[model samples]
Target: MTATQSGPRISTEDFRFAFRSHPAGVAIVTADAGDGPVAMTVSSVASVSIDPPTLMFSASAGSSSTPTIRSAETLVVHLLAADHVELAKLGARRGAERFGDDVHWGRLPTGEPFYPDANWLRGRVIRRLDVEGATIIVVEAVEARPRDDGMSVDPTPLAYHNRHWHVLTDRSMLPPAVAPFYAVYGRE
Candidate 1:
């Protein structure tokens, strides 16, 4: 069933509010198209496929980094952990100095700027679709790099919901049923 089949048409504010209640993982996208580097925080990143390693994210026209990201051939998508909440805020803040002297970022051999501290995937822009005031970008992942800290465990992921940042941990997990699928499949 679609919203059009329902009683009334959804307003823009109502659409925004509905998504606000949904939790999304946070990511910082960085691109450098020969001029300089630009970064923006987004919660729109999602895995589209696993065979070819594809992902998609929407870049809003309102963001200052949108133009640079659109023009770049390749970009880095940094999946933020709870420890990098400050970096996420830096990318989300409008007009903030994203790559200052204090910021620890470096350019990849392929020429895209990236944060080495975060688990990131570098990908080539495969497709771009402009819809409304945002551009939906599809990328084919070429390489992925994990944090250099040598930690064997997964870091607590950062999330965005209702205009606030959140962290996802094992404690947040709900008790599973007696015969969980993962347990039956011999997975945790």
Candidate 2:
């Protein structure tokens, strides 16, 4: 039965509409296949733990980068800054060589693609769950590098909601426990 007439049906459009209202931090998840690098823009990144340094993010199963991501030995998740709109757009795009000359990127020792200008966590996939239409991947952080350049390290995150990009800049009010660290280390 259709959602409107049904017992337990959920409309995809309605679910998407609800999600569109929730703002999420933007990030780029990158990995390298034997041929080259592949990536996708995702806002689903979430920290799962500190003990194991784990994080999770969802990637579309239909994405061109999906095969590479699934086959890759490691993944690099770059937390974007407010100024990374262009990179966000580029990563969001489908098909074509994303690591073209225009993109400033390098390779990690493990051969995963890396973006130096953002706070990034590189890790090995520990688990994968087939959920809805996406692949929910859990990665254990093997290494993490914060943006070292003074620029773009303001902690103002690049966010997405309702099909639009936004810069979350208001950081005046922070939790007491987090404020001290926020002031000292700044945002990532």
Which candidate number has the best lDDT?
1
Q: What is the lDDT of residue 38 in candidate 1?
A: 99
TM-score of each: 0.88, 0.83
Q: Write the per-residue lDDT of candidate 1 for residues 1-188, one digit (tens) a residue.
A: 86668778879999999998899999999999888999999999999999899999999999989999999899999989999999999999999989999999998888899998888999999999999899999999999884555633678999999999999988888677844889889898
List candidate 1 segments past 4 Å from native. Answer: 1-8, 146-152, 178-188
User: What are the runs in model 2 whose C-alpha is more than 4 Å off?
Assistant: 1-6, 146-153, 171-188
The Cα local distance difference test for each model comes to 0.93, 0.85
Candidate 1: clashing residue pairs, number: 0
TM-score of 2: 0.83
**Tens digits of per-residue lDDT for model 2, 71-108:** 77798999998878888888997765668898889997
- Clash count (model 2, backbone only): 0
